[model samples]
Target: MDGQVNRVPDGGFGWVIVAAVAIINMTNQSILSVFGQLFGGELRRMNEDTFTAALITNLNSLALNFSGLFIGPAIKSFKPRNVAICGCLFVSLGLLICSMATESWHFIVGYSFFVGFGLGLISPSTFMAINSYFSSKRGRAVGVSLAGAGVGQVFMPHVVRYFLDNYDFQIAVLAMAMVSLTGIFGAMFLKPLNPPLQHNNRKHIRLLSEKDVEKCQVTPQAETVHQPSEESFSKKMLSRLVQALDLELLKDFVFWSIIVGMALVYTATINFTMIFPSFLRHSVDLNSQLVATCMSVVAFADIICRLLLPCLTDYLRIPYRVVFLLGTLGLFVARMFLAETKDLRVIIAMSVLTGMMKSATVINNNLTISSHCRSEKLAGGLGLSMMSKGLIVITVGQLLGWIRDYFDSYVICLYAQSVILFLVVIVWSPEIYYRYRRQKRTTTKSIETTIEAGVEEVAKLNA
Candidate 1:
């Protein structure tokens, strides 16, 4: 197994874990992205307003992402595999129930609550497990893992539409439910990393070193003192709960910046998925074949970029934040161009480019979140980020639906999304500058210290 408690396994079973995560995300996240395609069918099935249809999708997104708040705690207490199995079961049940949905609340409960919660549980646990396996090739590994979802996005939409066209929404939902069950097979392959032990004195957590034993010795006296502090079971449980949720992560500036900045990118991408199809079909008066072709191009481009960009970033040794910002710029340009374009071919090209930009950001999102986080804190960090994503989707989602209802303008939506991305760049600019300054200062100080040491050595030799 090549298991090392503190260090990443880097290979061996880690690749299996990555493959497992890839499959898990393939089933879960693909559906999350393609709900835009499902929106019109859901609307007709439920006979709902635009806002209501959008809300259904938003709730699904919200639940899937909002459930991340608890996944950190759950996976910390239970094994990753165990958590994923439960998620798989929940997702299957949710989809099965959704196939029979006769009301809005049915979907809200089945798809949003159950399916979303399952997705939330699966992603963090799998990601945390995958992270324990690789360090150096982490970017490439993450890109590969998420690319499964991209691959699914490439084909699942078309498959779903085929069913919708030939049969009905119920059959499509039922078929998806069957696919959800496959995740359980993948979940079985997800192995947990070695458990961490508590340090006796300061209550620090430490995993075993290569010796397969605790490398740091602990005093009996310190252990005794720590035991007494744990006498209050209620307090200990409450503390454990809070720690599990990683509420402490909320105070971190870097974490906050990452989530907030990604939120803008997410808001735009999510809105695109929810509205773009309908916008093309009705608003632009595009034929169904052209719209479908554009979507397929976008999905395929997204898949290619998801696989390619992370490797490229690793090769170039670019910072994830820098890569993320560059993607934001690309998307902003695409969106602004979309707003100005009425030509079908230009829009199609832009859609592919938009997908490429969005996928680049999505592939980097996990790397960006985990890059600055400690191993113990990674799950909570991702959970919190997902929570933020959920909230943003909930807020912007309704506004997008309302915009469509009121204005009937996809161009306006693109413009609005573009403005938000611009704001993200504006907000992130100073932070990037500050980081540059800090790094420069650190380098200059190290050089001055080296120069001083050399001078002292010369003085001693001369004397």
Candidate 2:
């Protein structure tokens, strides 16, 4: 596309967007996604229905995942900042309304729908914007950007813990509303970019017969920024969606292997933070501040992982596929240690290690998709992966909640989770090697083609 600013500014406003978006995302993500863990006490107070209380989280998650489908194309259509601003409005209002809800359904329909709707605005566009704004530093920038979620993981629990302990759930909801509004304003700074998405349609010109590039002479103009009209994707979009997702992905042994591996391990690991707080409240006789402090420790650990792991990947000479398999090993140790739980020190260690390992999971999966797919469609492919991962998290959330309630011991769920993580670790090993070899071969062939092309040019000159 024309008029794209793909390079990161040396040291000016681009860095500012990173900080601003980070705060906005941290606040917004905490407000919407982690409500289950944070507001457990509040939801129970209002509804006396853990299931319905949880529905608020579940529905929000479903909407968050579903919105990815629409948000991708929207990136090309609307300016990134506009999409972000719209999302902020949806979430800020959702939180404010939740403070007034008298019933579970009110919270669900209002809080979940609107908040999910808002986050939908923010989530998909966040990475795409950073990718546009920052060129050389994308992985680090994205790592830093998405690390906002872990930042939320670090503080929001304690924030929720504080309000629940002191004032009431309404105050907590209202405070988070204020936090969400920050994102609304932050979205103002996002100047959209036309990223260099390589068009593969040359071989499929028949599919896009409406436009003739050779005759058209694409004039560098502002019109390029406008999104296509309402019916833009109306023709064959369903097929394109299917083809883009490429469920044949599931058929490929590596794809299925990676999906199952990521899903099971991630599903098991997602709930440790939520459950750990309750476990502390139950086992240790600790006050809310102590619990929040401990949670903060885990959050800091997550921040370290987010920062360190990306640097590790970049400098690491090994194939990332192998690194991903090795990385999941951290989860196994973390889970098993938590299950033992003979002492508080062990508990803390397990929590920190889990945070570190989960951060690796985030980086590895992005690496996985980046390696497999073409650059242009990577975002959409990633969206589909998120859709699957989100669904897995929802099921795991409910299951973890059930396990916590049923066994009355967080360790049991922790142990069960360890088993799943390890199973995935074992399953992913061979597949990781397969992908490593495939990419290696592909690289070798591309190098050979370049060498041959140069040789042919030399031969023709000699003739």
Winner by TM-score: 1
Tens-digit per-residue lDDT, 78-181, candidate 1: 76788898998899899888889888788778888898888878877777778777766677778888889887877788888888899888898888888888
Q: For model 1, what is the error of residue 160's alpha carbon versus the real structure, in angstroms, after optimal superposition?
A: 4.2
**Model 1, C-alpha of 256: deviation from truth (Å):** 2.1
In the range 20-39, model 2's lDDT, one tens digit per residue, is 67877788876654576555
Cα lDDT for residue 205, model 1? 24
| Deviating ranges (above 4 Å) for candidate 2 | 1-14, 32-47, 133-136, 152-172, 195-237, 240-260, 280-293, 317-324, 363-367, 394-409, 438-463
- The per-model lDDT (C-alpha) reads 0.77, 0.67
What residue pairs are clashing in model 2? Answer: none
Error of 1 at 108 (Å): 2.2
